[model samples]
Target: MNCESIRNQFSSYLDGELASEQSRRVERHLSDCQGCHAQWLELQQLDARLQGLAVPQDLESRIVAAVGAETDAEQQAQPAPPPRGYRKQVVAAVIGLAAMIGLLAVWLRPNMPPVDVPPPLAAVVVRSIGNVQVRAPDAEGWSDVDGPHHALPRGSRIKTPQRGGCEVETATDAQLRLDANTEMVVHGSSHMQVLRGQVWCQAAPQQPLTLGTRPPADTAAVPDVFVCPAASEMQVRVDQHQAAEVGTEPVRKAWQLPLLALPGSDQGELSSLVETLLANVGHSKMQFMNADQIRALGPRGAIPLLMYVREPSSSQQPAVRRQAMQLAAEVADDTALTMLDELLADPDPQIRRLAEATVERLSVGSAR
Candidate 1:
């Protein structure tokens, strides 16, 4: 590749777009072309510098003023409006239809960023009549839960009841690791509750742990505390005043129902646990809401997660959104489609990509 050609294709080459033949040619040229190499390095440095420049204040206002001035000047230069003509109306209608089709194409394009797609509604399990508990970190060498009573080293899987549940993560020595689908209720200073999920806890005295209603929960049941002394001994109880349990086997089994008393309250806890698991699973939560939920999650919850869906880092948004999207497909309706479209406007790029994928998934599933 010559200098000019290489320069023109520099971005594509940097992005690994060149085919084998072109790639070999570029490699050969780079080996002998010090000047081109220098230019490439300069371009990379320029990119870095440009990235470092922060958005200036009032950028929107400045751009708006410039665009408005241009438009106003153009309008002033134009003569008076011509009389209404059927031909002009027909042309305008055709243009409008074309624009609408173009927008639909953009919405349907998988490669393009998502825009105007609505988010799915949160899933509601009508009745979880039967109960079950399981653990995650199912991948061998990743989980610590071997059985009901055993605790593994850090990063071990705690069992969760639901299929798409959360996992326990251990961050420090005293604090035990929590895995997906795990729930714990703090009975008091003495005993901790495990309602029907998995948790990986270190048996340490100075590190007493309790599971109960946490943040976002209006009330908590009698807190349950899990005690593991330095002796590697463990106990579960509603409070320090009572012995919820003692010994390895019983304690392990009892951990399953830490939140037994607060089943409904466990929803918020479960949601929080899911959020935690998603973060550990290398995801971030972005807020994409329709016109309605935006008001509720905002006014009531005092939190807003609204954004454009096509911006980078949307993937890091809450994994729960994915679950919601699936649920929307199961309950396909105009409302669901509208919600998906609204989410398409989410500012997060990863979210936008996911929203698009979810739309396709729902569509395919419906067709089947």
Candidate 2:
């Protein structure tokens, strides 16, 4: 690749997000090109300086206060508080000042009111058939996605074992499927970096999916993004550090499309690292007392599980939901049960089996 192209990936390379071969290529280019190498060294120094600094404990609170406080313009719009010692000023002066203050406030008040906007949503991992895992942002290790708990942080990674693959859904209902032996780093809900293997994507009937691909060498200029019009599907696979697209195929809905549009909704809440351990029972299923035998488990065990089940934010991982369902029924936790009932309407056989088994188990226990 030329210097210009190589430089385009410097940010990703510095973040260690490049594929092995791609990373090696960049290293080679840096070694051969003095200009690029100098730039790279400078980048490394900047990163080191940034990393060595510690954030103040009140940094966040200070930032929030600064952002939420009235700006200088807003303060000025209130008319200087009548100068404090203006009691001697004539009544006409006071009347004129009041009239001018009202005019200024009306003219300088913001054109738009402050609207409370929620944070951006991300794609969630909804289906997993084999060994899948997700690595949280800035985390030191990868966690096996044994079951459930597939909500993704915007900058996190998801990978699958040789026989494993998973699906992700966006709030817009776009869905993407990762093939086995693939690693993908999601860039928000719409964009992703496919380091290896392939992905299938199907856009929602109304959502036009813009699939971003790695640009090609200078000699072969490729379009940066492919627009899969509403209701279309596409495939993207990595080859030689570039995304090679398979021509759009509108049919063949076997359910694994990484870049196509699919239906989605907001699911799952973000948790602190320690709190994550308690919430992620699906990642450590063995530690969970058998769902069928939770009768001996105390409120300590049951409350977190029930709380997780009832939380508005939850991924649609079948195992986690089913286990929570069992707990809800066992304790007669109507709210948790009601939440599960509403979420379980998909009737996908895998989910149906879980729902059916829960009902059957509950019924048989009552009969005894």
Candidate 3:
């Protein structure tokens, strides 16, 4: 990139707002261009100086008191009300003065604590399949939520019965798909906790999404997919995809998984790291290192790493098994179909259920 182009993006670069490619280019240019580098240093110094300056502790109160005194003096200096004929004008002026004083008092009120604002509604149910229900925060029981589209209130709990699923569109236009026999509580527009079952999500450009779950009892569990969208902030969580048994009845409803539109980037070194981590599966140190690297690698590093986690092993840690299920659901790759199929015959009921959900998710993702 030219010096002019690098200079134009200096502010964004300083704020870490530039894309990786652009940031790299700017850094390379700065290394070879002395003038631009000097300019960058000046900007950094100026920012540091500004941040170092502190506001006077009583500045607000002092300003308010000074303004109030000035207002009172001005009023006193003004000529007295002319006569009875000007009575209406005098009354209006008095009312205005009182209103001003009231406003000033409010503005100068001390020790007022900040109020917390709840996150705004970030998504709405855009589609629903068999036996989906919602329980509002104020409701005592689940109400059947039947339709093509509906607005889900914040703090509501949603459930999909056997053979059921649904899709939600987030404010950023990202899509989240829930698998059958799943339950989750919506925390905010961009955040939610998966109580049980799996969720498939695709983030909008520059709008990262987060899904939180309880920490696993087993230390070997696979961590959750903390999806950071293109040029966005990072969010992390642990994966816990354990399933619950409802009954002996067979699932009759069939729902397709939502199509995922992930960023197109080769895994490269990340894939190698994931392979090494899997080869050393039971080693805690290796697992920790792998988790750190995957997080640093971002969304592009999700797929095969998660696929490795999904592979079932009788000697594998419970935490690792659970993590694989959850990450599989998050990534939803078709390649996991064989492993998921094998899990169907596993003795553990919870693993079977988790595998079933993951299969559905992968099917949908693969279809797309």
Candidate 4:
């Protein structure tokens, strides 16, 4: 085989996918061509860098159960096999979606760092109902909760809008159930802060739980503090040996704060960075890391970039474009209604549906 043609088949060759005759020809060329051999070696070295892959098993079951729950019936397909390229796309998306927690926690497999490190699990997301979103500690925007979410890192914030509610079991064995219009921040194993809305706390059975409330709730039920969130915040503290204190005073760092200025008073650098990440959104390594960066840029600055990326004119991959649209929904507000309204005409039915939903949500939020 000629150098050009043989190089095109390198991935297939590495995957042991070449036909016998073609594989022999490619092998002959690699042995004789010094440059080709070096290139192949580089590819192998890069492949070896990815070692010790860890996929969270709890995360996997949650995704499976969530999908199983959503589908009302099972239909067997006996159609022709899909194109070879189709499977590649599906695998890429499924594996990389974690980096994309812009699908999950802590953000990578997106809640996690690009490197391998055991993230401290702060709590388990036991239940998620209706529309729910979570923001990783220091994340700039909410990530739509798809499927069952597990292993929330400390300091992550979960919110249930007027329509949704969620439940979590902390490492301390305490259980907290949030009602609609509630937002909560988990402060490690034993501490929790409910910024707003009503929440019922079930202290660890083993601990002498002390529960406190901002205003006051009936703590008559031992180990159970039914927080009547009437103008007061709730605190659930479960100590191994001490009484749990639950009370509401002033809320520190409530979810809504002044929006951050774009990396100081300058917009020039921020604009340039946005363009850079957009152009490289499909790069092998960059695609997995870009979601967090885009979210951190804030919705206002990303409004134009988001429109460009999700537009049919852009060159992003299908997965990347889908991620962008999902992100648009996360940060969407009344200010984004115009762009989302325009998206209503998108040729992709999925995008159109998402845009319609986002618009409705923005309208509702704006009214409030």
Candidate 5:
């Protein structure tokens, strides 16, 4: 490949998200071209530098204070506080100073009223791991998740899946709906851990849900951990070590395309590492997944492409959607077919049409 072509795929190559053929071409060129190799080195350094940047501790505190202030202001705007006994009044007096301070903050702040959004509803991202992943429906049909399995932190939201399906929604109005017979976990606040089952979720805004920390337990038996960030609204599913013949590895790994879209050195290597982690999901889980089973485990194979169809994000361009549809059709299943059929009644005619066409191709393969 030429320099431009090689450069275009540099990100994918670094992320290990490239197709086998593309990976080979880039690897070959990098071997022969010192310039591109040097470019790779620079990219690596840049990633390291970026990753080292830490999120400020004050961020959480500031956000909490902001919310508290907003609440206090609303309370003061009212004539009377909730009724309480004499002892309660005494307690209120002690805390009244802090409330007054919060009230002042609310008056001074520019954002104005702060809505009391629920924690689970505040989830901004929902990720499914282990066994299977699916979504419920929105106005459209079932959406496809492409980009990256780990794309939540990137602000890419999953549109709500169809009704009656196991889907998860995020605070950003994104959704993660699982099809029937699929099993997975939804981590982050509104924390849900799916053990050999399918689930759907809706996230709240302000704090996008992501996989937070997991509750301590005998991980060797569970083999999967889902964490809810403290007030962050992000859900994450971590593969845990379960007692099984699949060795000490988790069943599989799947990432969103956006995570692979990260800029850095060895984007491919890092993706590969995540993939290896998913593939090596500890215990005997690995042995249970056949080739097809492995592919269905995450976005690594065809699942991401399938999930992207319903994604109503600016990032998912038309051409990208078309390409993803083609890929999904190649591995379409009955669940996908049913989901597409339901999507035909979607409010977005365009999405409905796309689902119709894609489902037809998928069903044809099923017939054969």
Candidate 6:
């Protein structure tokens, strides 16, 4: 036989399905042609590899069960008719009596108490203060929250007034701090939304948590403290004891503030640096400045930037406003507090909301 015809039947020949004459022809061709012999060796290798594969543990049982159930169903659906005879009527009567007895037994069965399915565990409010309210997913409006250790369900919303604040412990052992005038919605054990206000979160190292202003578009977990700001729906990751401001843009070094790293330097040099940084806030090259720069500036350096940001005419950008608010928080002092108060009456609703939250945080810090 030609080489092409012999090669096509190699698989069948390997499986012993080829006729005796065809198998002999293929073997003779392999022996004569070195190329065909190499091809035959490859086919043998492939067969060996396939034969060495292990079947899944449950595969055989699952296949048998599926096929058996299908056969039984088909058989039951088309049971053979009994031979036409006088016994047909008797069989019908017997079947009718058996069905009636089954129905009666079912009707007389005693009713058992319903199973008590536990509610899904969510975050617990470990601590709270004045004006803190919660609205469950089922509830329409806000209601006074129970004092402390209140377990909230998914879809529940917690709101803190101007003088209110709270701490929450999530199921994954993560800690969340909600500042005053903040509203947050619980999505699940590891997910939540910051509708308005500031939320400082530290997730467990092993099981990171997720925080977003809206439902997360991705399901990846983040292993960092997330700072969610009001107005702009974005999450900013910050280190512990560090602060950051999240705006419309992605997280950058400029938004982060390393309070501990600030140098105790002269105020004049810091002022010039702050001015330089603010001037470059919107520029592509200087879109952000690191916490070290801001910390070096200290509260004094942050003051001028705050004023420039709060100015009604200075580039009404959300990024500028958010950075200003964050810088104000870092420089939490009388002057910053006064600016935040002025921001309370700011025309932008988001800026006003953020200002209220910042004021609450400053008040808390001052009290401490």
Best by TM-score: 2
Better of 2 and 6 by lDDT: 6
In model 1, how large is the Cα lDDT of residue 320?
A: 49
Per-residue lDDT tens digits for candidate 6, residues 1-368, read 78888889977876668765665566556545656665765665455434434444665455556555665686688897444563445445544554556546545777945544334557888777676888877778888877667888767889888876777777757766676677888865556667666766665533334465532335343222232221222433322223334433322223112211234323563554454455444232114666556656666655566666565545557676666656555655665777678878877786787778878877887788
Clashes of each: 77, 21, 4, 23, 95, 1
lDDT tens digits by residue: candidate 3, 293-345: 54554433444444454444323676665554454455445655765687687
Show where candidate 6 strays beyond 4 Å.
1-118, 215-368
Query: Candidate 5's residue-wise lDDT over 1-368, tens digit each?
Result: 59888988877765657776676677567645657755765664454434433444564455556655765786789866544464345444535455456556656998877854222222332333232223431223334543233223221223222222223444334454443343343332233444322332334332222222223365433233222212222323323322111111221223333223344323774555553443234112323434456446543444444444544441236555554544455555665665467657756556566778877766676789
List per-prediction Cα lDDT, in the order shown: 0.40, 0.58, 0.57, 0.57, 0.44, 0.59
lDDT of 1 by residue, 223-246 (tens): 233334322433322222232333
Q: Return the TM-score for candidate 1, rounded to 2 decimals.
A: 0.20
Residue 335, candidate 2: alpha-carbon lDDT: 29
* Residue runs of model 2 more than 4 Å from their true location after superposition: 1-121, 213-224, 240-243, 251-368
Report the number of the highest-lDDT candidate.
Answer: 6
**C-alpha RMSD in Å of predicted model 6 compared with the true structure:** 26.4
Candidate 4's TM-score: 0.28
Residue by residue across 170-197, what tens digits does model 4's lDDT show? 7657766666677777645444555566
Q: Taking the tens digit of each residue's C-alpha lDDT, what string does model 2 give over 107-174? A: 58888576443223457788676778888776789997755546776567889888767877765577
Off by over 4 Å in 1: 1-8, 15-17, 31-35, 76-368
Question: Local error of candidate 3 at 100, Å?
Answer: 17
Q: Candidate 3 at 254: error in angstroms?
A: 11
Error of 5 at 68 (Å): 42
